[model samples]
Target: MYIESFVEYNYIGEIAGLLLSGLLLFVMLYVRPKKTLLFKYIFNGTILSIVAILFQISIIKVANNPDQYYNKNLFGIQLISFLLVYNGILYCIFSYVNMMSVVRRNQRKEFILMYAVLSIIYVIGIIIEIAASGLYTFTLDGIDIRHFTRYYISAGIVCAVVCFIASALNRREISRITWHAVCLFVPTSLVVLIGQMIYVVKAHYIFSATTYVPIFMIGFLLFHNVPYDELSGTQSIYALDAYLMKNMGKKKIWVVYVILKTLDIENFIKKDIDSLYYGISICRNLENLSPSLRLYKMSDNKFVNILEESDPGKAKLIIQEIRGIFDKSRVDLDVPFNYTIIAGELRSETDTILKVRQFFEFISKRFIDHNSSQFYITKESDYKGFSEHYEISSVIRDIRLRENLDDERIVVYAQPIYSVGTGSFKSAEALMRLKVGDKLISPEVFIPIAESSGAIHMLTCIILNKVCRAIGSFSEYYDFDAISINCSSKELSMENLNRDFMEIIERYDIDPSKIRLEVTETAMFENYERANKNMESLSSEGIQFYLDDFGTGYSSLERVMNCPFKTIKFDKTLLYKSLHDDRMNDILSYMIEVFKKNGFITLIEGVEDESQKTYSVDRGFDYIQGYLYAKPTPIEEVKKFFNRKSSF
Candidate 1:
């Protein structure tokens, strides 16, 4: 008989395969990465594989037992057990494919239906197998194992076909890493099919291919373990890049970029609140916007939402909803949150990754420029703005690399400040200008970009050196007492700012008193302790610190009094407002009187005409600066205004 001719049990290969599978199971339980959905499925599948292998070994042992009772009931029990193990493996493959393809919550029904179909097929195949093989002899030698082999092969083929069709239909939605992992299962299924077919032909004991299930699962775990942000419960930037690479240009989509600034996590902690919970809550809210929207936490405070929607109006409405959520949260939550939400539809089919990244960079620039919430970037001008930002960032990077100051890429201009007491322009503010080919880019355009790119420090150093050089060389030809260089918040917060500034001054052999550093109230407050230390150290070296842009920021007169400042420069907006309202004029006069009484020199800038200059001088302003006296000009042009007397 066929059973008598069959080779002896392949105990060596079977035991080795079981040991390997057991080892993989141990690793899966203890050595896996984060427990993402995919990881859990693969882990469970591994457990099932180990169980099936043990059952297969037990069946082989029973078949080889010389004293075993071989009855129809026992045969039926073994066959059913074999069927359960085979079907369980098939279900594992189907679940993995379904998880990859059907990500939307609403599409879960489809996944259940697909699994139900596989289950129905298995039930029908089992019924037919049992009905067709009824009334078989009770002896093991009389039974044909080919009947069960046929059922196993048929089920494997059905599973392979279903998984392949599902993967093909949603190939674009699945990431490249996931797609490769899914494809690996195809060959694994084939191994099982071909191995079983060979067993039917030769009637010989062969190593069970179920052993490879754990190996395949290990490969799956390694390939599909996606990193995610624990706080927000969203995938990390790497997953976002993979998703964008796969889906971009395949369909129209909108990207909503969210940035949360000024989180004040320490403050929240002091109040016994979990600040990270807010981040997670925000992700949950945005995810609720659409079933298909995929959210990724790019960093601690930045999130990206990919929406597979084609309608621009719908996208805008979604953006508005995001804005509303933030606005409401700001008022309703105990901790006030600062958020900027920018959304735009990705129209270009090509260069999707580059374009999306550029848009994000642009959003960052806008956040810095305005420092406000609620931005919608959907127009052509917005894209052009991103292009311009990219170009300016490139230019700033190029300028940072150049060593020679005479390369003319970075130019210094001076706007003369009129001294009311001296009746002449004794000091000039040194401003930076960038010359790209023949076009000169405005400081407003490139300064923010420079700061964002971390090139502002270098730019500040270059400008300071040039200003010191100008004061040393041009002081003899031009009669200016000092040149004021603008210092940014980033520059003031530097630990070595005083050292770097003094080094430049000494290199040019100029008096530290010959240079005045103008810092805005905002800059001073950004990192108050650091800025104050740097300012005090620099002031002790005779480089006077002037509080620029007063009354335009979080102005605290008490805070100002604590700092060592020689002059207070009121912003032009205050001067403009004082001219229009009598109350404002009175308030400005009182402010100027208060500062003068505090023994501080007061300067009112933006004096456009004689009336404005006279108004400032009469109000006890020690200095006046604006376009009326002299616009910002090249160093050569500034020499003409040095000794010129003010009309006021």
Candidate 2:
């Protein structure tokens, strides 16, 4: 006989059992199982199976006769114990099979049937063990034990076979590492389970070896493969970053950064469970819409879609499809929400992973400040044929890469402001221009960068001081009335704005009356008291203030009335619309009359044609400024412009 005797079996079982128990403890504590349901079942089954083997080892110690021919009570206890442990193992296997099926997007009817059949078999085996039980009482090699039942062992073998087959059929549905781990478990478990049934091995050794191997495999797989987000099943940011880096230089890839407008982030996070379900629901909706669009969570109320389409038009079409999804389902959210998607091509040649991440940051800052719910497409058209597909991200990248801090690259251009009555140039607005080598950077590009970098105030000071010096240097050459410099919201809120203005004017030795500060109504409305105080302080010092782009902000007429602005400038969009529409002209005339009655000078900007200029003059506008007079020119060019016109 090859099997061990009673004393030898006990010695081997205790030594081996203690070592396996330590391994289990080490894996459970160090490897640390994931909180997934499949892992939970596997962990529980492992603990129960190990305990069953321990019970089998201690059976002889508790029995009345160690070498007895029969012990009915011990037999019943061992039969019931092994049967329960086998059933648990089978149940865990079924659970894992179901999990694989769901992940594979397969019909789970087969898994359901398998679970039902296995449950019935386990119930029958338990019944048989309770009603009729006996111990194998032969001292073959002096080892006393019960024969391993065919029913219980066969059930375990069937489960192993089913798990192996499922894994093979759904190979692509599983990760390579995960599939390999499953393969390591299923074959070894099946062979050991069958070997125990046919030959007499120590039951403690068979169960412990089979269960420990699979459990360790599962723990290793879970520890290494990180797929789902901690809060939901969506792909995590870590996965997103990895995928982006892998496809970084791939051609014709596009990513759309989506912002959920009106989403209350604080409230959503407060209700964490609902928020997790909300994220899952969003992923489900995206999957239902287009599985090709892989959604990744970017922020609390933001998501991104990465796709590989050669044509940007196809990406746009996908964006429209996502819009349709949002339209159909937004009302179902617990709170009202809408989406603003910013999309462009993910260029290969010039972009890196860091540049792409910076692009997202730029989009997020713009979305918060604008609070707009419309799709903003920064397509190839904006790049002027630099590439077949260009993105706004490149523009942001250029701005960040710029190292022009000393303001040497900054230039001031003057656009003539003409008197409507005389049609003669008197004042000119100082527009800030940035140049990189010979290329002129658009205000649309640099202004937002300035705002985001917290350098708008510094940029304003630079422009203001430069404009003053330029005008002061040329104040003798031409009888110029005043030069208006644009001020951003940040500049108006500066505590030392009044001092900054006075010091610059004093340094240039220029008359404060010759320099006007131009502000938009939005700036005044955002910080009304600060703006009002600064406006009064500067106006008292002989510097004038003009409300630029009036009627385009959220401020009411009453709020505008309280500001110490001496002039009001109409925005180009409002002027053009009023010029084309008779109803809007009547409203425009009413606006002009209201400002005129309040002793405020009204200037209508964007008068680019004879008809537009005629309308501004006919409406009794105090001043007119647009391409109709002259495009923005340098300070020297402005002097020559008036010198050549003879109107000055």
Task: Quote the positional error of residue 360 for candidate 1 in Å.
Answer: 4.1
Model 2 alpha-carbon drift over 4 Å, by segment: 1-225, 229-234, 247-351, 354-405, 416-427, 445-483, 488-516, 522-544, 552-555, 572-589, 607-620, 628-630, 635-648
Identify the leading candidate in terms of TM-score: 1
Clashes of each: 0, 0
On the 0 to 100 scale, the lDDT of residue 320 in model 2 is 77
Candidate 2 C-alpha lDDT tens digits along 1-648: 334445323335344654665566567667554555456655665566566566655553433244553355755677567667657666766665546433432355666676878688767866765455343443433434434345566777777787778778866444433465677767777766676665444342333345344554454344323444322334556778888778767556777778777557766544554544454455555655554566666666777777677766777888777766666556656766667777767764337776676655555554676644667766455334333112333443454456333366677788988886665788889887766557677677778667766667666677777788777767776776888999898779778999977877898888899989899988886778888888899999998889999878877788778888889998988888887899988999998999899999999899889888788888999998999888999855676554333443
Give the lowest summed-lDDT range of ten residues in model 2: 385-394
The residue pairs that clash in candidate 2, if any, are: none
Estimate, for each residue in 1-648, the C-alpha lDDT of model 1 and write its tens digit: 233443334545557667776776776666655564555556666676777677666655655552464555776777677678767776766776666532422377777776788788788878876887742222343333555655676677777777777777766555444555557766676676777667754754545545347544554444444544322336778888898899887877788888776657555423433443444455557666776677776765677888887877887787787777677666666766677777777755225686688776666664665655656656777777776666677788887777454446789999999998888888889988887768788889899778877888788788887777777766666667788888988889999888887888899888899899889999977899999999999989999989999989896899999999999999999998898899999999998989999999998889998888878877889999999988998865777787632431
In candidate 1, which residue ranges exceed 4 Å CA deviation?
1-3, 8-34, 37-207, 210-223, 226-352, 360-377, 401-407, 644-648
TM-scores of the models, in the order given: 0.66, 0.60
> Deviation in angstroms for 358 in model 2?
8.0
